[model samples]
Target chain A: MHNRNAWAIAPLMALSLAACSGEADKSADGAPPAPTNQTLAEVIADKGEMDTLEGVIRNAGLSDVLAGKGPYTVFAPADAALGAAGSDLSDEAMKAQGAALLRAHIVPGALTRADILAALERGGTGGVQMRTMADGLLTFSRDGDAVTVTAADGATARLTGDETVAANGVVQPVDGLLVKAE
Target chain B: MKRLIPLTSVLVLALCASSPALAQNGNGNGHGKGHGAGNPVQQDRDDDGDDDRREGRRNGNGRENRAERDVPRNHRSAEVRVREIVGDPPREGERAVRELRRGLERGESVVGREVIGPRRDEVRALLQGCPPGLAKKDNGCLPPGQARKIDRSQSYDRYNYLWRSFGGDGGYQYRDGYLYRTAPDGGLLGYLPVLGGILSTGNVWPTQYTYQQPPQYYSRYYGLNDRYQYRYSDGVLYGVDPKTQAIAQVAALLTGQQIDVGQRMPAGYDVYNIPYDYRDQYVDSADRHYRYSDGYVYQVDPTTRLVQAVIQLLT
Candidate 1:
């Protein structure tokens, strides 16, 4: 009687284990995964070259939006670019640049590097006139291997290195300080 | 023992009654002889003491009343001094001068008391000497035909003299050939030339007269409506209107997303970022996926991705 009872209990335990494994597999296959598009915050965290720009971003109090889930085209300047332009990278200078200079760097939509370059080539004015987040127009000039950007106030800046893709936006490194005309 | 107690009680009552009477009499004469007999010298002394106390009280009341009356006068004098220091009286004086000017402009005689009595003859002579046949209207003085010609010739010879004495610019010619000067109101100051003829009423030649025109409107650069250009220097943004070249310093205290120089920013485009490479172009590419020519950073629009910040930089 004892031997018969053990045999019956062993089969029931095996069936229960099998049912648990099947439920686990179904659950794994049930829902879709998270999206692959990185947010602006994710992009900044991933790209390591935006330390100086990051400081400015914080001082200008733009961390929250840049870190949010949107496709933004950020014309990011490197430490060297700011140095070349003779901008004292001081907290005071960053504060002085304020929102106006920052607005000049951003566009409304996410523009890929290829799309921007292609736009510059097609615009035919030797550059493409892109309205900035500041309502000011930024003109893009292509020279051989490098690109030059002129602000509405006639301030010119050069892109030194390459484009960086963040989860939320794209950051293009620049080599000079672009100031608004007074 | 009971009888002794009653005797003591009676003695105590007598003593209490006697004490008050002695105190009342002590302030009066020291006499209790017979009915009202007292020391005459002591009575005179008491009377004199009472009189002195009454006199002191009267004097004190008079002093207090005098002080109370003087307080308002002192306050009034202080107020007058403050008004004088603040030049309120001078402003009033200017108002009086304006009234006089208005009266003169209307060709009306001004009547006011002088330091001495009014000199009616002097005033009449001054009025009679005014050039004959000239328009006596406000800011209107024109010389007659012959006198105008003579003055013109003389003005050419003595331009500086006419400019100093008659306040005339000989070079300036009005449409009516009236030699007008620059008035304080920025309008034409007209003057009439004096002829060698005495007025019919008096033998006085009108000379050294000044004409004042009404105030005119002048439009300055501040009145224009144009976009203001801005430049950043020493951490401050300065607004410069390209059309007028008017410069205004932007206030440092600002918050929002837009870059406005003199005007307040609108609602939606309030988030801002500092511009990178403002004047020149920059090339940037990384990770082999993206590339661009101009590396101008901007504050991107959150909803529509539109860039709506102030174009502070102008060519």
Candidate 2:
């Protein structure tokens, strides 16, 4: 039976499961090099074209979560692409909606270009289907040398730029925002 | 004296009858050997990794079936073991405790089955001092006439009642809409009225908890492919990709009605096919496949539709 104590114990479980210990980067003792020189949130903020997306993340109250020791991959949207899609980035009341939209582009754990390619090779024609944090699925398939991500509602986006391997994760610049169509 | 049969002759006849029974047992053993040694076709099939141990009784008790004879009288199968637990009140509640054991196969997940094990002895103890007419029901010491009729309304009302206690109000406490044993304890024990008892609560006050709560990132439990970082706090099960670090929630757990493992999820249950893209977490069943229902993934055998391991999603 779930009681008050059981509920209180959940975060402690998370604390235990945070297996990545110490600093993400190398130290004086010469540990393995970090995935990237900076954390994921810092990497996102440093990106010149990801200003709108960065604003959205901040508005969603997720700046700390994404920045904190997260191993999350953000298939972040380009400014021009966000504009082309006509996404409402300025809406004040759509904070929750903004968070949901952001989650559609994100996945848990660190997925690099090599990982995606390996997944494609393993899955073949059916492609690699990844569950999004927003409770939807994104199917990844190869288009020539470029990779494309398709949503459950059939909306598609292509990975446009070199993946920014961050300290905690990767920030992939996509040509289009990975929003699921209604 | 001429009409009466002699005592010595009767004894001899009884001995002759008993010999055939032993021979019958021996013949059953012989048949198993004959199939293994003589039949090349059957031997080849067994070599293909047929579960001979599983089909032992049906295969006429092979040479390895020594437990049936060598076992002590105290050794009982799960069925008999459950039946031996005497909690005959609350009418169907006691029967349900036994049914849990009967429903499970050796290979299947026992997460749901295990829910009843600890309570079996507790119920047995409660029945020891039960009143003549009154029996254990609704986890209380009551008769069939006084048994609490379970319904969604009652379950809700019981959870909301402010007068509830850990050891008061019939030796049971209501928590997270499930019945938990109080300090005193009472009655026949079983799952909730609908099934699967109640949904596991989030890591805070149930009221304060909601799926909308931001996902908690973890480096353990359920994953898609090599991605093992898990997110289960929102009551939705998600796997974090090892490379990208993006978490994907298995969407089916968000909406499907929860059902316990060991019980066959009815055909009507919304069964989501675990996509080929995500690597198998609990198993890679070449002979069978995995399915996602409610909040858990299950390795289900296609031939028997028996749900195997319920993928562990919690700490």
Candidate 3:
């Protein structure tokens, strides 16, 4: 599918889900800004260190989706996250692989740390199944205060700190990449 | 009058005896549900047994034999030749073969996915009506525009009989050690016999060439925390200062020699624990590349190495 069309549908799905959950707060236009703080994009932007992810979002042309009124759960990776990736992507490769990689980190619901912890508590042996924007499942396992996120490809990332409260969603810093399953 | 009375009595006695016999037989033909000519219970059991056997055959027992027999000897021989050359093919390399076979069976042109060599039309014609004993040589079977030979002396190490198509889309790739045909769009056609090239001395093709690197200077920061670590692209490492979150590039931190860009790290170090968010972003190289990600800087795995995310490396 064309990248533009894929991204266009993602936001709509997220927005519709948000509306269903009573998460969308309307002002003038049908698309209303989040009631709380900045959007997921703004939260990342506010952090000067996350330039790589911001560049990916910009390069992949997904700035609007992240900035839109979405109840997204973004597992924001740290700058080291990109460096920790074994090799570097070319400009062309960044454009090609960035959106899919970024989408894998963003889930549909604005699930906060507490919400995740609560779900994990109720889930027992089975971890919480958070569906990513790319339509893959991220298994979240909680151990006391720390939360470990397992990607589809079996790579694991730890939630580094407290979840950031964004206007339309929640942002949690992950130590690793949430690689999509092939 | 006495004689008539006796005859009537005899007829009544015969009727009573026949009535009792008919009632015992139920259907009156001496054939009932359990005692019928056709046993429904036994028939059902036989049908179920046949179904089970059919299911078993479908599940690889019987079908496997048939599949082995059905494979064209030439194609099977090509795979055998490949195995002989490679000794044992890796999983990924085997996948390449499977891809080639599927494309050929479906009559699809594999023009773009690295199997570039011949036009789809040419390949279809050759495969559809492949002559018996179509040995590895480029028989004049292909029309003039179908295949044109190219010298692979400089770039390719193994194969000498390299042939590409006229339209610049597809052709045949015959490595001295490897054997396969490519469609016009670079899709794999299928494995072919040792097409007039010396079988490789041994499988020397690099096992680890799968890692793909992400863009340079790309970094994402989660938040300011005590756990944050820092590094310069030049191989320096620093711990994030707790109070200020400031980091400095310390060259002394690198224990071994400085690794050049594109140079794979020599195997010795242990695998650094990689975080998840960056797993999908690494680049793969033929050789190992030095990478610093997660907390510790490390080497990318020789096989399945992605420059973006950490696989396994020397400690």
Candidate 4:
């Protein structure tokens, strides 16, 4: 009777140990588990900065596109960058320029922050030009810790702060307007 | 002396003969009250005078009524009507005269009201009937010529309106008689001008284009006060001042996001507080995918960077 009881407890202990080890393995893998079908709005909601980006997004006229099935990389401009653009950035003006700039910042495919940083680090003579969802080209450059982007029209804007990784793509805050080439 | 006496007697006889008929009509006889009791000729003369007086009063009253309607009650100036018609060669002048005459026949009051209180349809009709030269002009009116020239000029105004509406220089270049905006990206965030183009198609009514900016109460959560509030739609953002709640409502229609009131929103979403200010900040979390703050909720795209969805939180 005692031998039989020991055998039953042994199996239970072994199963528990295996479960612990599996959890440990998952933690060791630094990647965050994949999030399902989360929208850009949902992601921003988590950060508590949706209001700041909302105006810029609306001005860019990309609300629908961003809400759509987009694995889009958005080079979002912070409120400070937007303020620095001056009072002339009226609603009408933003509406006029928002779509193009938003398109310029976005790439249709998912690009992790790691990928962008790596691309910037591997700088070549030609620099890296990523095709935007708008069919325009966005050029990337790196100066030590700072990443600079020269839009299609040679308008240079600097990327600021840490790169945020979302399920669909990456978000890097930018300072200044991204002009599209004619 | 005998001849003078005979002339006086003839005059007296004539006066005596007409006196009875005049008295019968003038006395307001009870018989006259029933239509044909009085002589028809005398009644007809009196009726003609009364009709003339009534016609004069009507014309005067019409002008007064039109002036009151055209010029607002607070505005003191009398509104005047001015219609210029553009025609080709000698016929152009004739057409202009004819239109002016027609306008006159329509009554000055009507013309004045049409000019002062212009409607979208009226403007459209005017543009459609514009002469070649007078269709579009920088300061005054365009001169009449080929229909193409008039059409080009009219279209130019539409483009100018689009540019001005989007906060761009109203000047548009005409290349080979085609109007185009020179900016490569074209206006504000590259959305306004394109929107203007779409609007110019005239499929939608002008009254339907009532997009306002977002309100200040919602800006507190995002740390944006009056400076940055704007609306986004159709892949473009519009920058408007004095952001109103209506903007958020319109944005919801454009973006397919639900902006409900009184809901506990996610950390980054917009929230409205009474007595609006710019300093309101709330704890941001990655779990809550939507939030309502500053009279609008920040709609998030869960698939992108945690902050990428912030763009949709706009006015």
Q: lDDT by residue for model 1 over B25-125, one digit each (tens)?
A: 01112221221112111111122332122110111222233222333322211100000011012122224334323433342311111011111121111
RMSD of each: 38.8, 24.7, 31.5, 31.3
Q: Where is model 4 more than 4 Å wrong at Cα?
A: A1-37, A44-50, A59-61, A84-94, A120-125, A180-182, B1-135, B139-179, B182-315
User: How would you encode candidate 3's per-residue C-alpha lDDT over B1-315 as one tens digit per residue?
Assistant: 111011122211121121110000000111112211232211111112221221111122222333334433332211100000111221332243343334323433111110011122322232222222333345222223444334432233121222221113345444322334556565555442221121111212111111011111111121112343332111112233334433321111111122221234432221221222222222223443333322223334345331111111111
Evaluated with lDDT, which candidate comes out highest? 2
lDDT of 2 by residue, B1-315 (tens): 112111122221121122100000000011111221132111111122222111112112233223233433222110110101111221332233233234343422133231101111221122132333445655444446753645533533332222121123444333222333434345434212100122221111121111121112112222223334332322243343435544432321232123333456434211223322222332234444455433234555545665543332332
lDDT for position B100 in model 4: 30
Q: What ranges in model 3 sit over 4 Å off? A: A1-35, A84-92, A180-182, B1-315
lDDT of 2 by residue, A1-182 (tens): 66988989989977655534544332334322335677667888888888888777766456655665444668888788777223453343334345556666776555666667765775686777665555456788899988998877666999876676676556878988666432
* Candidate 1 local Cα displacement, residue A40, angstroms: 3.3
Docking class of 2: incorrect
Reference contacts recovered by each candidate, as fractions? 0.00, 0.00, 0.00, 0.02
Where model 2 places Cα greater than 4 Å from the true spot, the runs are A1-34, A84-87, A180-182, B1-106, B109-315
Expressed as tens digits, the lDDT of each residue in B1-315 for candidate 4 is: 111011122221121121110000011111111112122211111222321221101122223432223423322211111111122212222232343334323322111001001121211121122222234433232344423555544434432322221224433432221224434443211111144233211122122232222222223322332443343333233333333322221122122122221122222112111111111221223432333222222323233312211111211
Ranking by TM-score: 2, 4, 3, 1
* lDDT on C-alpha atoms for all candidate structures: 0.34, 0.41, 0.37, 0.34
Report the candidate with higher TM-score, 1 versus 4: 4
DockQ metric for all predictions: 0.01, 0.02, 0.01, 0.03
